[model samples]
Target: MSKTRCLLLAVMAYDRYVAICDPLRYSLVMNRGFCVRLVVGSWMAAVPIQVGQTYQVFTLPFCASHHLHHFFCDVPPLLELACADTFWSRVTLHAVILLFAVLPFSMIVISYVRIIRTVLKMHSAPGRHKAFSTCSSHLTVLTLFYGSATAVYFKHCSRDLADTDKYLALSYTVLTPMFNPVIYSMRNREVRIALRKLLWGK
Candidate 1:
């Protein structure tokens, strides 16, 4: 599940970057046909990624039976149970996670930071407010998503890191996605306008 979601997020981040950096060319470059291809590409790439992660998770030859941990069976917690030599798989997964999971997320953050800077530089108040209306919801969602993910990945657990880690993880895992649509729907003028037009026969 995490593996699948990670792939989905990768494609989303890629699309978001293209849209933000070159809105004029985005439709041409990531047209409907190409967008379909990107979705397929994300799945194609996900095969190798999931295979590698699965390999690292179940490869340890001397692991004990008690494999579950922290609400779900993650690769890292399973690796911890392995009494055998998992130095290589551990190192590999660590590298892959940093490269795939962490890297795209960082790109999202950078893109938003760039967006905010650009929006803030607009000349008129209405233009500035309108620009912010497009991005503020996304910014809030990013903060919640990244905040929880970083907490979980960095081993900031409930007992050791803080009692809040569990709730934080749940926030990102369960609530963040749900809240994203809400935040965007309410704060994004375009979305609200569309909704109003749809509901009020405008």
Candidate 2:
């Protein structure tokens, strides 16, 4: 699910890039068929890699206690229980993270770089604001999701760090997702006004 989300977010970034950088061709380029294929491709790409990783992790010999330190059956926690050396398992895990997380993140960054350049070139201040506004929610969600995920996964996993990893996992797995709808819905004017009223009682 996380990998699929990353890929879908990449697709969203591309959609925003075309919408902002080439507004004239946005409709033509992001047609329904293309969008469907992008979604399908994301699922197709994520499933096999995830399945393989799960298989690899479970296939390892388990001599330690079955109890997991983390809340879920994550790679880091599972690796801790493996009786084997786990050197190759850790290496493979990092490689998968690079492919699914880092690569998609790089694509998003590239899209935003070009978007910023295009927005800066616009003559109207309102136009610039609007363009940036369109991306603010996505950027916020991406930061929350990617920042915590990277912290948890890319770190050197160890028994001593298990507690810290669990907290970080909560950020991406629970908190980030919990806030996604609220963050994106803030783009709606009525929602913003209602929020102000609820907060300020005015």
Candidate 3:
């Protein structure tokens, strides 16, 4: 789920960049077939990293207490219980973080930079407003999702996991999913219009 989120959010950032920076070419660039390919490619991209993370977890022998501070099963908490040396597993986990987290986040940042530059150049107030509105919702979601996730995964391997860390992890895993629809729907005029039409038959 985490890996999938990273890829999809990056795709969304790219979508925004294209929509704002090259509106004329947006349709041709992000067409039906292309969008399908992006989704499928994200799923495929997640597979190897997910498998590696799973493999690292299961191979370790847990000798310490089974209790985990975090609500969900994740590598950081699981590593605490392992009896054997986890140097290599930690290395693998970091690699996964770099691949799945850092790379996607870098892409998102780059896209937003271009998005900001393009949005600023719009001469009309309404044009600028529309451009910012289109990007703001996705940026909000990305910040909330990535901020908490980075806090959890980017810590030093030897650092102790605190209660605050567990809460942050919960925010990432649980709260973010719940917030996504609300953020997108509330911020989007088209979605609200569609919802109103569905409800009132207008």
* lDDT of model 1, residue 32: 92
| Order of quality (TM-score) | 2, 3, 1
Better of 1 and 3 by lDDT: 3
Per-residue alpha-carbon lDDT of candidate 3 for residues 1-202, written as tens digits (9 for 90 to 100): 3988999999999999988898899999999999999999998988988887898799999877888766888888898888999989988878888888889989999999898888788899999998888887888888898889888777764446577788889898899999888888877678888888988988
For 116-180, candidate 2 gives per-residue lDDT tens digits of 99999999999999999999999999989888888888776567877888998988989988999
Question: What overall lDDT, based on C-alpha atoms, would model 2 receive against the true structure?
Answer: 0.90
Which regions of candidate 2 are displaced past 4 Å? none
lDDT for model 1: 0.67
In order, the Cα lDDT scores of the candidates are 0.67, 0.90, 0.86
lDDT, candidate 3, residue 114?
A: 90
Off by over 4 Å in 1: 1-23, 62-67, 156-167, 187-202
Give the winner by TM-score. 2
- The C-alpha TM-scores of every prediction are 0.73, 0.95, 0.90
lDDT of 2 at 117: 99
Query: Whose lDDT is higher: candidate 1's or candidate 2's?
Result: 2
